[model samples]
Target: MKKITPANLVPLLTAALPEKDMAHILNALVQFLRDGGVKRASQRFDLLLDAFKQNPELAREFGTRFHRWLGSIHIYPALVGLGIFSRSGFAREMGIRIYERFMPSFKDLNNLRDVFLYLFQRQNDEKWLHTVSLLQWLSLYDTLCRHSDPAAVQTASRHLEQARLHALEMLSIWVAAEELEPEFTRLEPKLMEVDSAFVALHQEISRLVAHYRSGQTEHYDTAHIAVMMEQCRAQVERLRRKGTGAGAGSSVKVAHLLERLSQTLDRLAVLLDIQTAPDEKECRRHCVRLLNSLTTAAVEQHSTELLRRRSINMLAKSISENTSGHGEHYITRNKREYFAMLASAAGGGVIIALMAGNKIRITGLGLGDFTTAFLAGLNYGIGFMFIHIVGCTVATKQPAMTAARIAEHVEHKAGARALESKLAKLLIDVARSQAVAVFGNVVVAVIVASVVAAAVAAHTGAPMLDAHTAAYQFKSLQPFTQPTLWYAAIAGVWLFCSGIISGFYDNRADYLNLRKRLTVQPLLKRLLPARPRAFLADYLHRHYGSLAGNFIFGMLLGMTGWFGHLLGLPLDIRHVAFSSANLGYAAVSDHSGFLYFLLNLAFVLMIGAVNLVVSFSLALTVALRSRGARIESLSKLIDTLWLQIKANPLSLLFPVQPPAAAGGNGNGGNGSSANGKAKE
Candidate 1:
């Protein structure tokens, strides 16, 4: 095979490349590269790159599709491993290029939202949290540049307020939780001491905002901000010591205090100018101060506080914790079964509802005005039962398994290095499962809508027999007919929307929380017992899994309208199906018995199916993607182990030995002998 170059593969990728083919190509490229067919490998690689460069739309579509496929397979771990082997400078360079390509368009709010989301996903796999942090800072800085515009400033002000509110809420939650802990009994006073400091930080931010609003440049002085920050750090330090002490409640109090302090610091950092180099420096200085404060307050100072200690120790414990007993059992027995059962029950309910509603309509029932109402009731009841069963099942099962897997994976001796590789793959599997679930729901919704619509059209002439005219007559029922349809349609649409929103948000949030746990002091301590530096280096790799989830979820959401249309359902049924007939006119025109029941039945099915398919598909895709990522990540991790071993045989024993020296001479023996002995 000829060496594929960026230029050569562009046409193929641009021409709606199939996913299977894409994967095959990638596999081939990998093999070719391994076999020293660099020219062929490069040709293919260049084809992809050229395609991306020449056609923005194609680039976007290809990127999105590729990302989706990767997400579905939970292939982030392999990518992460690739990234790790590729070298930091190269990764950083690619990251920078990505940023440049997308940053220009981010001036628009929607674009900004997209960019933020994109950056968020990038944060998952790329060793670039600091880079992302920088980008976010810059984005905000750009927004601030338009400070001269009242509307812009107002927007910024709004965002700033929201950030503050979030910080406050987090602080409150942390504080309340801490106060309940036994260790906080003695540390209460020390915790209180920092309250004033927090108050001051809040006040300073408020003052800075006011100063900026009033047109006083000096009011945003970095020096004064630095001083307040220093004080906040000192107070935080004191609180840390208090909580870390021997008092039974100290640990709890300290954890709460540190959490609050961290939030406050984050808020403060956001409020400051961070555009220029100097501004960035100031921001970093303050950030470091806050980090130091958190470290001192929560970790170093509270070393003895069991709660505080536990906070730090939990990661390690989680990693090392045995899964052979309850953990494993919970995952396999309780978790999987629960989700599976829920899915089955939910699916069954929808099927039953459709069948029942059809049967009722088909049977020429004599129940006059009550028929439509009865059908609606039946539909809702069935829908609720299905949703409840599935929801409960998912709730009971997946989380425990997820936690257990994470614990087991991170605890293995080689877990830290392997974690990055595995995390992405796991995430991808979860994402794919979630996508499948979403797709399934979409299919169900479409099917139900089509079925109901067909049924309604067919049953336009059923008999209306029983009931007092005053209570159950056509006029009285007329008002409800359209509204009920509207309600169902609206509910369906809402479900679809909710699925998209929740899936993306939850996936991203999970990744961020995981990243935070992995990077944060106590958690980091537990997860990276052998090599903290290696853990940090690989952190970005793990993050990619989450990014993959977000991208996939978003893509799925984008396709909802198209999918709905494909499924033979109207995206908006309000105008066509539920537009209220002239109120006074509808009463006189549509009093016929059979027509109304059919309409009601149709609406019911449409609503039920829409809700079912959308919700289920969203859930399933997420799960699949996450699982796939985990599996792939584990595989790549083995490869990473081998690579590390090959690169430096002696360093295998001393995993903690610095990479710089280990990679340089190949025989440096500082800590290598001890490490080798330990391994032996």
Candidate 2:
């Protein structure tokens, strides 16, 4: 294998270039090297060096001619006040050098583009990639705009316009071809609609042109005309990716269409007066934006490229899909299911009480703060995992999951009125489910903690929580005077984050076939009996995301307070069920008055509300954004919710009984009742 060097390209460059221009090119090269500074110049020096070596006589002649244009090469004049040594200044200087010497005429630029096209065909060579990148062309254009004369700008614009024209011709030919009938069949209606709109726009433009010619330009609607043109442009773009497998004729036709569309859009942009903006920088910004939109429409229509462009949205959508099962479980459609949710939540509340009591012990251990946090994290994580494995529901975890389901419903529902009505009913279902879960968790957690406290005091001859500890617990649960509610919101944020993580991992598991891979692991075979190994793999396949989410949620709650202490900020998590349990322990230990106990309990409920609301709001926002669903204004949502409440007064608080079975021709029909029972 031979080592590649700059000198190896000398013969190629010499063969490609005109001998008469070699002296001017060499002189410009020396100036470019001097003015552009060593670092950037060094990167391109090898290419210039190789080309110079092609004709020694030309290089010698260029050396004598170099001084004549040395001053012209310094396009960036030093201005201390304006900061001469900047990116724009450097681009300007480089642009002028290339303009005056390397491409002194339009023919030279055309030759360069042709060479680029030829080299691009052989792009397997790594160097070609660098040469063909759009950044280089864009930089040259920017430099010409900054430092070159009107003639230079006209030359560049003419090239772009020519390219634009070619794309149009190609597209028109492709659309009119007989072989394109199948693809065009699907697109014909949309094309007709867009074309009609364009025809109308043309008529309007004709009138505007006449009005301008008659010296009555003030009557013209430029903004409206711009908007119509924009709509037409968008319609054209939507068709760009409709078909595949282009023959030579079709390829040429499609290429023409693309060029024509570009030219049309550019003409409209110029008419919009983007080039004549009051500020040059603002004009450039608009120009860039217009160019970018055109370029994106030209190239990004392929189905495969859409994935690369919208990767984040797709990832989020995948996560939301994973949470659908959990979300559906939160909406109880009958009395039986409603009670089941309550029972599940109550069971989860009992586990929470146990975890809270254990956490107090872990914190009381004379361990350092982080060590204690770590232990607490493990305790909470394992406790939550047990709750999940046992099929119990945590009241707070439902919001993040359910939000995605609601967003999905919003997307699939047909009309605005139908969607509104369905969305209203969904809110009723959500509200009832949330009300029952909160009731279950807070009531059961407090009762369980009170019983446990009483039992411990009776046996140990000491209160479950000592006086100082009880006071601290009471203080932490206080919402208004203390920062507890803020901590509750922090917990809500963590809940949102944990949901995202769960969805992310679930998507990863599906995408990467994690369970399939796990089943084949040698460690599983070595560590377990056959049946147990099979069970473990199957269980992990189904439950891995749920377990991981709960464990991480627990860890976040456990570490937050300790993290806060370290930062000297009042950062902590106030989970509703845990706070209620703590309140019960405090009340029992401190022997608080009824009023004070009631106030603390109220605060606990308020904290839970904040947790649920914050988490649900964030999750819904993400879910809707991922699905490209527009969220309604708050007032409209509230109004719809109120209408739903008025329409079905009892549905949001209690399950509605199924309607009576129809008596058609006296035939016995129990279908509705059976369906209702099935739902339960």
Candidate 3:
């Protein structure tokens, strides 16, 4: 038989191989490239490049087919590995198909880097290069997915997706290896030495791998793993530059070692939670795309990568932590929890009623504008804190935290219709929880305000508010007459902000090790006994976010009126509980008729609706955006919501059954039935 060489084999495969066996033939070609040694492989790769140079159509078919094969398998695994799965059958099958396709070829090729190098040298065209680079990336990914650590899978998937995007933008250039060689020659050989450097790097990486295999990963330095990998990568970079133009055949062993080193580094990076430079990954991706081209297809894949960059991972994780009921009991999961939520709201209403009556009386004392805001904020903040300490729920404050939880679910479950149904179930739980809380708040607020107003009247021989004050308070609650609804929405926005503040502080508590820091505080230890100081430290760590969120929310509400006065805008908050209490006071001060009293009561309910709806919508929007989730099919979601409502309308008003068990499939809506609460 004639000795196989690139010049004849390239033509023979194109002219003779059946189209049905393309993937098999490609696998064979990869094997042949691996076995042929560097000199022969380089010669064959160059001959194939010439063939592509001579026949553009043939080049396009090769590029297109190669691109199809590489991309065909990886989409599902990539998405699944990145935690971007819909968790549907489709996603699972995609991952399985990718695994099935790649696993069979794994043992046949010992060094994928050499195969990539062979392809990279002939990479003068974008289409061909894009295909080959994707194949190279898939090989690395396939190896990593069988591991135990989640970090490796996440990092690799993210890197691959980013690389694809970078390739599209940066690989469009006409890069000629012939032109690059002169530039390559100028770089120092000592720095570019592949043989010795790769061996050293390989041995170092193998040691780390051996440690992990032996369950001695604890001895590894996690922080410097990425740095070490980059240094090893530099060796592969030098050989990649030399290609066949200088002495490619001599570096086959280096390529083989480099592959092993790269794989080991990938596992170690995940084990240590060490991050790689995204910029470097992008550069590598562009290089691979160019290498795959080898003067073939020029088609550029559009950048479909989501803007949900890994930079937001920290922020998202914080929000997710707060939303998941992590020892805080915030999500409403069962029937017992639901009743507890209502009871808490009722308690909050009593506190809110007193706060409202006090704020009106204090503001009427003719204190300076700034002083009024400061005093009012103090009253509201302390009162809100009191309610929280007593385990009471504030109706509007639930959305911000719950939105994060819901968004997390959406991330794991992706299809539009599926997401819509999931949201509907969550919405049912949310709606019912809010309904009960609002019911509790409004009823108690009205009752408490009435009692407080009468008590003030008996003591001071005057109602809590004058006629002017009474009229203004009533108008504030009336949705149709003034900008009350808009102001309510503004208050809703503030509620959403408070949720973010709570989540931020919660995350900060963990990140800064607040309890540990507090425990060691010199003043705390010096002034207090060990046991007392430890107790105080633990308390602060657990309740700091709640204290902060409530205080800030109070300040926001109080300052809004003052800011509106300063700007001559009619801006003011209309919290449902507070507004309902105000309605009771206004009714008594004005001695309004029965009909007028009923109308005011109706207005208070409307105000509560505005407050809850606006706040929840804003919070959910932010939560979804933070996770890079955009549900484009609002109609479908609406339809699903309607179907759910139709199926169980009572669920929107009241949970028909007990909430699921704690940590069950509960909505995590209003949180647990625990005695403590986080409130706005």
Best by lDDT: 2
**Which ranges in model 2 have alpha carbons more than 4 Å from their true place?**
1-309, 414-416, 529-531, 632-636, 657-680
Q: What is the lDDT of residue 300 in candidate 1?
A: 21
> What local distance difference test score does each model get?
0.36, 0.61, 0.58
Candidate 1: list runs displaced more than 4 Å. 1-195, 215-219, 248-257, 270-680
By lDDT rank, best first, the candidates go 2, 3, 1
- TM-score list, all predictions: 0.25, 0.57, 0.57
Model 2 C-alpha lDDT versus the unseen true structure: 0.61
> How many residue pairs collide in each prediction?
85, 12, 22
Q: State the lDDT of candidate 3 residue by residue for 297-382, as single tens digits.
A: 11111111211232233345445446434322444546677777777888888888989988987888899999999899889888
TM-score of 2: 0.57
Estimate, for each residue in 8-37, the C-alpha lDDT of model 1 and write its tens digit: 656654443564544544434333333433
RMSD of each: 26.6, 17.9, 18.4
lDDT for 172 in candidate 1 is: 33
Model 2 residue 463 CA deviation in Å:
0.9
Judge candidate 3 against the unseen true structure and give its global Cα lDDT, from 0 to 1.
0.58
